[model samples]
Target: MDSDELSEKQNRGVAARIREELARRRVSRQYLADLAKISLSTLEKALSGHRPFTLATTIRLEEALAMRLRVSETLDNVAAISNGHADEQFGAYSRASVAWIEGLYLTVRPSFGDRQAIFAYCTEIHWNEAASNLRFNEKDRLDAAFTQQGTVSIPNLSGHIYLSTNTSGQQRLIIVSRPSITGEMYGILTTLQAGRGAQLTPVAAPIVLIPMKALADAPLGRINPDQPGFDAYAAYLKRTVEEPFAMFLPGVAAP
Candidate 1:
């Protein structure tokens, strides 16, 4: 079937399951509407099958119901390197391609002013072996883990940890440590300022994985972006990303 038809079918499935769960528990729709932080009318429409679920909305619904609506198999499949692609160029395919980052980390970045550490947030990482991907469920699962006391738990909100090879044959891992995207402005500021944007161009800094003991340690408090530890961490990450054969080596660390 086409994309639209598939989406509609998924929506119907989600709506049916949500309604069934609610009915089984004998709870009011308003209870979940409030939990999901969506309006009554909006929740009504979604529950009544008038709207399709976006990824963001699906996450919110998962949080509200304490269950994954429908974990698609597509989310876990990694595209194979094209046939005849040089192993040196594409890197060897392995079940361990993205498993080393499986743990908790406090993602940090420097802000424009004072170079103060922006405590982007604590993100938990895990391997989605089925999908051959890294799972970072910082925003959804960790916060809700302790809440509701008895809510049902699912595997995780797993998605692909994007990676691509550059012309130099270096592998770059793109990480979105922030829960929300920030930093965008339009013409008035950009036109007046030297380094600002004249038109809307949104950009957010991403976390680059470097082999840091602290990243694995996940110290109790927020990480300082300017600290020597973080400095070494960032440097190691950038340097490694530029290396030609670092990751493919056996027994090497993951980022």
Candidate 2:
């Protein structure tokens, strides 16, 4: 086949696979478009064969669906689109360089509703062969449905790491200092606070990601003051403020 014909065939194959995923997942095209951060019109045109899918759009769709759409030439190349190096989108880190971070973490942060309670969960960070970047997923949550999974950004200039989730354009961010000698990361988490039915307010709190191995006996999920491990978990969280990992500025009130 000619180059143009081959490209056209690939586009049609991608469109078909995307349609299959949409149907299998029972998700709407509008939802997919929104999650992929693409305009509905653009998605519709590409899926309907009115326009070809651009590489950027295809990558976005793959990320949204958490699946590969392109048929690579070889399995090795297919394993990493960047040949084991993450693209600029994820700080261009290589898989080998970030190998040390591939492990489970006990993620701790303050409860949005309870001032004295600390919320604890499991966050697994590992390399994604398909995307060639470190990805993180949250588990062991009291509310599993709201658990997040997204790419990890390790920028060298700032000497900080970021765990961010972007769902339908709403973003949640956790900016943390690099791992200490004990592999603990202290930082600040900014996310939407769910209020009474459909109400969400912006909220920020100190957050910590401790290597699960370091606290194998620690408890998970809603560590209240009455809980056994609450003191230890609270201590780890306090370091976020005491060590001054992040600062919250209270703006000047009206005089």
Candidate 3:
């Protein structure tokens, strides 16, 4: 495809994703533009995918909205379509289902609990029986661990991570937007109450594999957890986590 066609396709995909996210949050275009610190026209272009969001633009939006912002390079390449891996392309048609499911999770799941939301990750993308009955007190455990050890650094960035949940009561939903390489920065929930862990199930959203150690650093103040530094994290993903993961936990598979 020509440059115009490629840009058009990417723009359409990004626009769809942004619109869905905005609708989920019930925010308007002008509000988003203001938060992103961009002119309305610029915001429109970025959403349209004619302009891939620069690191600064994304950071501004994340802070203004107080929501997670992420970009998966594995999912960003527009060439994937012409290369015939259309399923992996960055377009509305390619990600429609995943975005819809994620939108649902973002909107519907928040009402289920009041615990501090934490986004946790596993070495593998899929869950195994060993972790099936596992009760994770995401923030509580991570906080305690951090207090004692300083901070944990996660090494992976694009393979798999998860939210904390329970059976009787739901803890906060840890939404892992991106993985940290040397810091503990993550999108965190406001409050964390003692609650039950959600049973492991099919992930409704795209999973970004992250290293466990990086997560430790962000919460412990070793790095700036703000959205502006996300590109640094993304850089980690491109260099490290996109491929060459360690051994898989037994019985785990990509869902």
Candidate 4:
């Protein structure tokens, strides 16, 4: 097939897959448009077959859906259709390694009851390019047995990031999200503790967000726990913030 025909076929496949995925996941057009960084009208047109997806648009879609729309596997040779000549716009992709996702995030998860949030210093991130998945570890656990290890899988049925751990015969699942405008990674924390319930369902609560380092050697100092995880946060806060974290603990009243 000619290059034009190949491109058109790929575009159609992309549109179809997008429609299928949206329908299966019951995702809103506006939500996807916002996540894909595209206008609602443009996303509607592309999904409805009124317009083909541009390379940039396709990249955004891939990131949002965690699925590839094109079978080329490499964006190196994708040139503009004009004059059937290679374009310089895609020359940057020839070097590869552009699709890698890696970073460290100071995460927080909810503690049981009404206790304050647990601040996890996420310092290690492992992203496997070939496997298309990632894992991270948080080392700020006050107790050695309570350390957290996280894994981020490719999106399929859900768009949420989940961090799970199985230790001491207990299972915990923390549904997380990407960084916010304020650079905080916040989400819901849930656990499957049979002692807490009889239905085998997960109990969930909103987590806390404490950025480890917002500035160079500057402190985010967001962890102000009340009872449960306050000790660990105070330990972290003492070294990270300008003020002592003891002031934020149970007896100390952070104001």
> Quick one: best TM-score, which candidate?
2
**What overall lDDT goes with each candidate model?**
0.41, 0.81, 0.35, 0.50
Looking at candidate 2, the ten consecutive residues that score lowest on lDDT are 1-10
In model 1, which runs have C-alpha deviations exceeding 4 angstroms? 1-9, 12-97, 118-120, 127-137, 140-255
lDDT of 4 by residue, 1-255 (tens): 333332666777677667765654455788668766789998888777677778778777766654445655343323322223212422212212322324555554443333454444444444422223344455544443334553454343454455655443355776545445665444566665334455565666555344555523322223455444557554433432233211223455535
Best candidate, lDDT? 2
For residues 108-178, could you state the per-residue lDDT of candidate 1 as single tens digits?
A: 33332234443333445443322233333332222232112111011224232332212122122332221
RMSD, model 1, all Cα superposed? 14.4
lDDT tens per residue, model 2, 118-208: 9999898877654567878777788765777777999888999998887657789999999999999999999999999999999899999
TM-score of each: 0.33, 0.74, 0.26, 0.37
Error of 4 at 1 (Å): 53
Worst 10 residues of 3 by lDDT: 146-155
Score candidate 3 by TM-score against the native. Answer: 0.26
lDDT of 3 by residue, 1-255 (tens): 433322444445445656765654455798668645679987877775556666566556544433324424356443432332212211212222222112111111111132222232222121111111111212222223211000111123443323443222323343444334432223322224333584443222222334443353332111223434344544443343245222223465655
